[model samples]
Target: MAPKTTHPVLGARALNRATLDRQLLLRPASLGIPEAVEHLLGLQAQNTKPPYYALAARLEGFRPERLSALMESRAVARIVTMRSTVHTHTARDAVALRGLAQPGAIDRELALFVSRGGLDGVDLDRLAELARALVEERPRTPKELREELLPHWPAADPQSLSVAARCLLPLVQVTPRGLWERGGQVALTTTDRWFADSDGPAAGGPADLDETVLRYLGAFGPASVKDMQAWCGLTRLGPAFERLRPRLLAFQDERGTELFDLPDAPRPDEDTPAPPRLLPEFDNLLLSHADRTRVVPADLRGRTWSGNQAHRVFLLDGLLAGIWHLDEGKERTTLTLEPFARVTRADRAALTTEAERTLRLMTPAGVPHDIVFATR
Candidate 1:
């Protein structure tokens, strides 16, 4: 049987279904840890520990321990890889994809610290030594490390050289620390101490490049080459796309922009019923695309994507419903929704009721928390 094909113009529904489907949020979370990680090309790990909940919400059968176990055993590693941020990903991916995104990582790190004193009078070799000595054996917080390094880099600012040197070199923050519901604190260690072999950089096609593009398309495609470039931070998807052109399925959007995807991947009916769902800060669905209109509402985009400050969000008939902030205190855990637009009283009430239920679930047994809707 021929594979099903979709026309290029994927509106909010198509985009939402694709996003949810890829995120595994549409279906109840059922996949194993490693499988889930492989599917999303890794969760947006910049926040370190939060992806576990992001995964748990999507993968019904998630075990927080599996990821920590992967991190400890080195089957997966915490590498300063994609988007030039810290993420815990399968070791195989860290080895392969980091090479592609390293330049961005390096640039971001350098820009962060160089101005304060990263490349100043001090010797870099010694700086690396100092950083290693500070964090070795045990993971250290950026704050704690900064305090210790103050004597060495008293003149340097935290942003410029401190974060940059780590970017240029390979390092991994140890975990057990990042597992779900666990008290996750940041700590650094050399990637070699854990994963040992670093994936060296290699130029396009015939190598991991094609496989990388295919994996990306399978997990995040039906997207343009530009989207692939944005997610991977790689400029050479042209050649990778060219290499896979024959095997890929293509369609032109309303603008005639070509989009590609794995021929065998799922593209559910546009009529698929999408439920209201909550997403973590830095969720990949929002960050993966160059044009996010399909999943994120323009009005709510600026606020909800602002990390924990934006809190959680809701998918109202597949469009964003602005930002949500959850406050958990001794007596109760409260959830507040900050909508970007005027929701009908009925929808507002319904959302409030659901938020209350969510609060109850988040804090079982004791006093059920209050869920409130607030105007932005």
Candidate 2:
């Protein structure tokens, strides 16, 4: 066997700065929404508001209407892609990345359905074709799609049928559901129909996976293969990285796990001052890494999750500091900052200022908003 490659060692703080800089979290980026979305690979958007909040926090002049227009114009879309969850991705990535992730997502969905006897005699290929036809005709809510598919697979569970299609196909969540300040049911369309005007077809096979690995490294790297797997729910990506090894930079974290990143990516000094900022629920920063200690303190990791949902968290000095929630009233909105540990006076003041700026980005101009720190 070839001798083990020695890489630079990066402590947790150094890794934290590198990741934050790449994530556009250490400082807001100057890029437009679409460019930023592509760079980040996509934002966790199980809920409509998180994408807007995420971009607002990361972009220099992000506006809710900007993202809304992207959705309205088919420049970006909400789709079930990474980690088998809804993400708001640029239209290009919505197509390219979904195809890369579909195989595993579909297998998991089918396994669950089969174990429950919900997919008992249904032919998945036929189901996919039929589901594709239905969604292609027009974007339909999961309920509406389920109802239509039920007639064909009458014995299969309605929910399972809809989910199988979601897993198997590249379905894009149509506008209004993901539109800023607009509430609507989750609706689905095929990527092909949704981005018909785009250059090439949705990417597939190993080549796209290679692209995905590079993009992940660019956005969240100095990460291990396990971290990439955790982020995208795709396994066996080691070979993909191996192929690009010469083009990549390698590092070892404090724990000795080898990390891979783009050769030219930023790795800032460990002492870099990370600003106080609030992250949206299920922010990728918390979810993207298998070893998340770079951003989340080991002692506080267990606290970030409340059942299945991860709460919106705040960061100070590039580490998880607290959780926050918004209380929107008709006339005024209150942002409550709840810290996990004792905060110094200086940190608290900075936290308050960041919270106020976040409120301005999140709420309408005329709407009043206030920031309150929850007393321990």
Candidate 3:
């Protein structure tokens, strides 16, 4: 057996600290915005706008337009990653993730739509070939892609076509829909055309979940295989860890749940001071865990969920301390903090200061509203 740490590797705080180190939230990050974006599997851009704001908080100097440019140039693409939701990831990741995620997404759609008789005996390979030819000339909206393919697969429900094509071809919704500050509608193209302008995905193939797993633990380490699965939405990560056994350092939590970490990964003392930070709504840290009690207090988790149920949030000492809203249409921003319990005057001041600065940055030319506090 490999020798374990003398102290038996303390509990979840140790794990949480390891996660903090990899994430750079324990301290300010030194990596470039693009690199940080890549490591986090493209910053979870479902709402389309918060990834920009999220990066600005974590990265030292981030600009929304740079991500926009990367999207336009196809260096990083917008595609589905974990949980089968849209993410803005690099070209390399987009391909691999699609390969792995497509099968699961297909199984889901087939159950949901197949009983409706949309794909009885339909040859998907033939459909993919035809769909590729149909869209190669230009990027088409989802509706357009459906119409073009409908004549051949008349039995296929037009509304279900987008989900079917998503599983068949590694498709990406092209910009200016994904561009920062752009209101452009979603336009469709295969990930190849969206990234490399070819109709085919690169031959190298599916993203190795083992390699992807190591990178995940590298960025969010001292984490369990369960946490690994939560972050990547892949089942059977045990094999990935098995392949990685030689390279990893292992421990057991208080519950004796086995956990893994990178050998040289950072593990700061629990007392190590953490700064106040505002996280974007749906930021992966909050999403990428099964037992959020390690980070969010159970009493407050419901409040955090309800507060950020819409748009954005603020973090004080790594917990979701409050929620912030940006009312762009009215050119005003308001921050509502629902403290689980009473907060110190000093911490409240700190949150206010951070909230004010972020609001100003997000709504630079707009009128400002006084920050609001509501306790539940």
Candidate 4:
């Protein structure tokens, strides 16, 4: 059978509008926090503040308190999922997707540590069990958890032992840690204990990978097999896409990579206007695709990535236009915007308006903020 192809091509701008619509960046969505999180597949939350900032940009009338409350209530959690990095997921996805990513994520992690002799003379199964018990007894920071496990595996590298448990077990970073505007250490508890009413990976194993692929496409698609792999850190998803190909709508980029998307998913017109959006650092929109030209321009791609660090970036006319940073002062907060290309006076005003809105979402009421446009 001939491989399916989408006729007439989706040009770069067309792909950009479609992607922005699906990501909720074209307009603020009406969905609540948990629903929005689920729809976006979860937000990259390596830091405490990005998820809050991300929600602010995507959801209408979003309040930091709403996300903070969800954290306090255990409705959402911070867990190491896709790409083996921390993400803020609704309690349900934290369990389901973490399980799907584990076989590969855990093996890679263990292999690296074992090569360093980090797990030498240590029985990993026993370490996992002990770590689970300690965390379940009460939420404990990685350092605290390490001290408790050291007695059991005295010769094992403390950092590696803790990391192995993280890889081997299903742990969730408990609250007060990810709560908005609150300071707390990175703490862990088993997903089983954190979401007592919910089922863990045992209830949804490899079978869940099928749903994972569909959900990824729903949120980030018209994407290639490599894009799916990049987003989830799972390899060999071509078969999963093949299995679902009969039901999916296929398209090809100008570069001719095969793309799959849900038939009913939104594909906005090429001219759909995308507002300037101030995205938090490591936002999934900037990281999810193999061919990021859909969102970030080809010539400007290297600007956002420095070594391993991805900077906070903003979109102007639906493509990455600049990078931004925030500095808080005792009396006022300043948001600095640095554009990679020339910005018109009109664009600067619009960018300032968006930056001010972001400041309001991030800081307390009556805390004044100033927007500074940096020299290119």
Q: Which stretches of candidate 2 lie over 4 Å from their true place?
A: 1-5, 197-207
- Which 10-residue window of candidate 2 scores lowest in summed lDDT? 198-207
Task: Rank the candidate models, highest lDDT first.
Answer: 4, 2, 3, 1
In angstroms, give how far residue 185 of model 4 lies from its true place: 0.5
Candidate 4's displacement at residue 284, Å, is 0.3
- 1 versus 2: better lDDT goes to: 2
lDDT of 2 at 369: 81
Could you tell me the TM-score of candidate 2?
Answer: 0.95
Q: Give Cα distance to truth, residue 340, candidate 4, Å.
A: 0.7
Instruction: Kindly report which residue stretches of model 3 are placed more than 4 angstroms away from their true locations once superposed.
Output: 1-9, 105-112, 197-203, 302-311, 329-332, 365-369
Q: Relative to the unseen true structure, what is the C-alpha lDDT of residue 53 in candidate 2, on a scale of 0 to 100?
A: 86
Task: Quote model 4's TM-score.
Answer: 0.95
Better of 1 and 2 by TM-score: 2
Q: Is 2 or 3 the stronger prediction by TM-score?
A: 2
RMSD of 4: 2.3
List per-prediction Cα lDDT, in the order shown: 0.67, 0.86, 0.71, 0.86
